[model samples]
Structures are given as structure tokens and as C-alpha cells.
Target: MKVLAVSSIGGHWIQLLRLMPAFEDVTVEFMSTKQSFSTMVDGKKFYSIPDGNRWNKYGLVKCFFAILKVVETSKPDIIITTGAAPGLIALFIGKLFSIKTIWVDSIANCEQISMSGKIATKVADVVYTQWGHLEDNKVKFFGNVLG
Candidate 1:
């Protein structure tokens, strides 16, 4: 399957990168806010979209279209993200296209799934949390990125 792994820079990127080795026999691409990640994710396709958050409505809108463009051009079978906001936009687009979507909440949200993660429950086909306690009616805990 063609997979688009989306994340912002820093920890979210680190979490997504850790999930790479667990995935096999598929084409994997990356979407990030930093073009420098191209070197970190060498041998895979990479896209840099505008970094945005819920507080930044304008930036979020730009990122939404940026993500849509990537999904449209790549036609990925599935879109997965360790997210803040950009990945949520990808999930929304994937859902619109009837593509599979996965949202892996950032490990930093040990106390609970982030607000973005909570929002994703509405659209994501699968929602994963690094913390066992975060698993509930909406979220699933299947180990963690660090493991």
C-alpha cells in the first residue's frame, strides 16, 4: 500500500519515524513542516507543508489545502499521522476520499490524548495512543513508538 505518514516537526516527527520499522512491504512517504526532515527520512518521499495549529486559523487553512494536494497527487491507500493539526487535516481529506486513516497521538500526551487526537476520533479509521490509560471508547493503545 502507498502510505503517507504525516507529522509536524520535533517530537511528532520522532514518533512517526519510530513507527517506520514496524511497517513493511509498502511504499512510505512523509509530510512534515520541515524540509530538513528529508535527510532524516532518506530514501522516502517527503513533503513540507505550512506548520499550523488550532490557534492559527489562517495557517491551518493553508495546511489543509497543502495536505489535500499531497493526498490528491500521491493517491495514497492510507494516511497515518502522529499529529498536532496538519495530520488531522490529512485525515479529514482521506476520509473525504474514502481512504483509510490512522491517527497516532503524540507520546507527550501521556495523561490523555491531545485535543487534536480527540478530534480525530470522529474521522480517523484507527486512533492509537502511546499510553495505556489513554485507551478508552475512542482511542486504542497498542504499545508505543518508543517500544
Candidate 2:
């Protein structure tokens, strides 16, 4: 199966890389923002979508189109992501394309729910929470530290 793992740079990027071993036998594609951390992902099938901040409207448009192109070309069987802006876009596109999606909320939101988690929980096919106590009918408690 082909899986596209998406996440932002920094901590989220680190977590997503941990999922590499799980997809070793399958085709894996990665998408993330440009950063020094991406250097660690050498020798992998990957694409870097320009990071979008709230203020960069032009950049956001460009990145959105870039993301669409990647998803269309890759046609991943499944999409998994950790909370970040790009992940939200991937989740929406994946669902629209009938691709299976797994959205894992950030571990930092241990007590109160995060905005990303809230959005993903409403849309993702499978929603995972790092904290067991945050479990709900629509969420699966996968314990902390997914990556």
C-alpha cells in the first residue's frame, strides 16, 4: 500500500519520521515544510511544500496548489499526519479523494484540546489522541508519543 505521511517541521517532523519503519515494506511519500530537520529525511521519496503562515496569503495560495498537485500525482492509499497547518490541508484533500486518513493530535495538548485536534476530529477518518484521557467516541486512544 502507498502511504503519504505529512507533518510540519520541528517536533512534528521528528514524530512523523518514527513512522518510517512501519511503512518500510510499502511505498511511502512524505510532505513537509522546508527546514534543516528535513535533511535527516534523505534518500526518501519526499516533497517539500512551502510553509504557510497566516499572513502570507500569496504563499498560502502557492502552497495550497502545490499540495493539491502532490496529492493528485501521488494518489496515496492512505494519508497520516500530525497536527500542523499542512496536515489539515492533507486531511481535507485526502478525504475528498477517498483516501484513508489518520490524524494524530499533538502530544503537547495533554490537558485541554487543541484547535487542530478539534478540526481533524471532525473530518479525519481515524482520529488518534496521544493522551488516553482525551478519548471520545470518535477518537482512538493510542497513548502518547506516536513518533
Candidate 3:
């Protein structure tokens, strides 16, 4: 299966990278906001989305265009993301394309529902969380599953 792993630049992206080996048989690609992403995950297919910022209008616009390009080119069978804004956008796009989407709640979101978690839970085909209390049926307890 073709997979698009979407996440932000720092820990989120790193966590996704850690999970890569498990899906070695699937064709995989990445989408992130870092300008120097190629240096971080070399020799892999990658698309850049603008970094998240509540005050940067231009960044948001750039991200919109970037998302359009990503959705068109990747055409992935499954789109998975570790939380934050990028995951929210990817979830919406995956829904539109009828792609299977799995949202992995960030390891950081221990008690409260993050912005991405709230949105992704509403749209993603599967929502996996490390926190045991995310009792929603569609949300699975995947505590430390990446390791």
C-alpha cells in the first residue's frame, strides 16, 4: 500500500521516522514544514508544507498551495500523521479523496485533547492514542506502539 506520513518539523517528524521501518514493504513518502527537510530524512520522497504559525498569514497561504500539490502528487492509499496543524489539513484532504487516514495522537497529548486530535478524531478512519483514557471507540490504545 502507498502511504503518506504527514507531520511537522521537530518531534512529530522524528516520531514518524521512528515508525518507518515497520512499514518497509509499503511505498512511503513524507510531508513536513521544514525548509531543510531533505537533510533530515535523506533520499526519500518529500513535500514541504509551511510551518505552523497563528500569526503568519503568508505562511498559511503557502501551506494551502503546498497541500494542494501534495494531495495531487502523493495520491496515497493511506495518510497518517502525528498531531498538530499539518495533521488537520491532511485529514480533511484524505476525507475528500476517500483515502484511509490514521491519526496518531502526539505522545505529548497526555491529558487534554489537542487541536489536531479533536479534528482528526472527527475525520480519520482510525485514531490511535498513547493515553489510556481516550475512550472513543474509533480511538485505539496504542501506548508506545512506535517503539
Query: What's the residue-level lDDT of 66 in candidate 1?
Result: 91
The candidate, 2 or 3, that scores higher on TM-score is: 2
lDDT leader: 1
lDDT of 2 at 14: 73
Give the local distance difference test score of model 1.
0.91
Q: Output the number of the TM-score-best candidate.
A: 1
Candidate 2 segments exceeding 4 Å error: 35-38, 55-57
What's model 1's lDDT at 39? 97
lDDT (Cα, tens digit) per residue for candidate 2, span 1-147: 999999987777877887677788988888998755556777667898988756777766777788899999999999999868788888988888999999888788789567877889888999888888989998888666653
Candidate 2 colliding pairs: none
lDDT of each: 0.91, 0.83, 0.79
Q: Rank the candidates by lDDT, best first.
A: 1, 2, 3
Task: For candidate 3, write residues 1-147 as lDDT tens digits.
Answer: 899888887778877887777678998888888768767667678887786555777776677668767888778999998856776778788888999999888777778657778778789998888778964676788575455
* Model 1 misplacement above 4 A: none
Report each candidate's C-alpha RMSD, comma-separated, in the order given. Answer: 0.9, 1.9, 1.8
Native-structure RMSD, model 1: 0.9
Q: Name the 10 consecutive residues with the lowest summed lDDT in model 1.
A: 16-25
